[model samples]
Target: KLVVNPEKIKSLKDVKGKKIATPQLGNTQDVAFLNWISEQGWKVDAESGKGDVSVVRTDNKITPDAYKSGSIDGAWVPEPTASKLVSEGAKVLLDEADLWPDKKFVITNVIVRQDFLKEHPEAVEAVLRASVRTNRWIEDNPEKAKAAANAQLKTDTGKALPSDVLDPAWQSIQVTDDPLAATLDTEADHAVEAGLLEKPDLTGIYDLTPLNKVLKAEGEPEVDDAGLGVE
Candidate 1:
């Protein structure tokens, strides 16, 4: 999501010549933001993060502080940071989800070393089963899941998101067993367009059989790997 200080910036075009921040120069959100800028006919040196709009590569830990202090006008970030900025009075200018088909995209994915998978297929299946069950539980009981996730976040980070931030951030995310492979391919293309990556040969990049097996056992439809699945 792109969260902006509404009092300072009202629209996408208004962002030109303003200061904006991304977590890091070559990270996923940074690449996406750079690609969007190029699409707008705005010039930004992908490597230097300079040109029309100053792209400040701020660390996520201090991004909210930067925004609060008016050091940056807006940010392209993922949740809970996006929600944290909202708590600080930032308004979401873009959802990113809205830009994709069906409003679904990959934010996180699970990958195991090829050797580990080959030697421990059963272990992989067990993990997939747990993943499927956990996703279903979250879907069936969203409020409780949110609380549980907040508890874990607090344990890990020494702070829990306040309800105002947690509620919307949790709502924006989707938990599912599917890897949403097509969107992963699209994201790679976005990075390429932003000059962050060369055209990647993604053949055999997925081994979804284990995930599909678990899904079928749960009476769910299988997910496609966008023709990049192991044959």
Candidate 2:
């Protein structure tokens, strides 16, 4: 967990009692960290404070500052923010990219209502195509994306993000067009494990025939769930 002791400590042998904070417990970062800790034969002893690390929950802004000021160790956060902390002198303790490696570290996703997907599979395919095109556009024009993010932030939060946070934050977002992206499945699996999902019916969860049609017309193979390595 890069949010705490950001070093490549290699094992739970090192992270035993360091204080850590995340947006919330039972979130992906928290659950994944808990899973890792469990593998180490030591427990997350919140009460005893033995292997007892402090788990503080704080607002987003405080997370970076807390890590920087030494009030907290590290945090599970996305880039540009992770990059922001690093540029502001917080190092990359661990990257989710490193944990999963080229598999998406999904911060967000787009989900259409299943009934809609079923009713208008063509519309789903069109959207996925647009999404892919948008991704390519973003990658080619980072500044435009930044400006868009700034506009959104200003509209919603009424302020521009400081450049330190903005620049790296821009880098952290890896936009992809795969309508049936594997990372979606990965997140789905995570959801089931966390009990956020009662159970995921893979077939029910996807309507990839639309995506398949899109891919075929484009001269690409159909979207492959297995290739995404979600399972």
How far residue 192's Cα lies from its native spot in candidate 2, in Å, is: 7.2
> Per-residue alpha-carbon lDDT of model 1 for 143-184, expressed as tens digits?
999999999999999998899989999999998777888988
TM-scores of all candidate predictions against the true structure? 0.97, 0.72
The residue pairs in collision within model 1 are none
lDDT digits (tens) for residues 117-203 of candidate 2: 769877877897776667667888889978987889889978888887787667766775454456656656655554446666555
Backbone collisions counted per model:
0, 6
lDDT (CA) per prediction: 0.91, 0.61
Best by lDDT: 1
Ten residues in sequence with the least summed lDDT for candidate 1: 26-35
Q: What is the Cα-based TM-score of model 2?
A: 0.72
RMSD of 1: 1.0
Quote the lDDT for 157 in model 1.
94
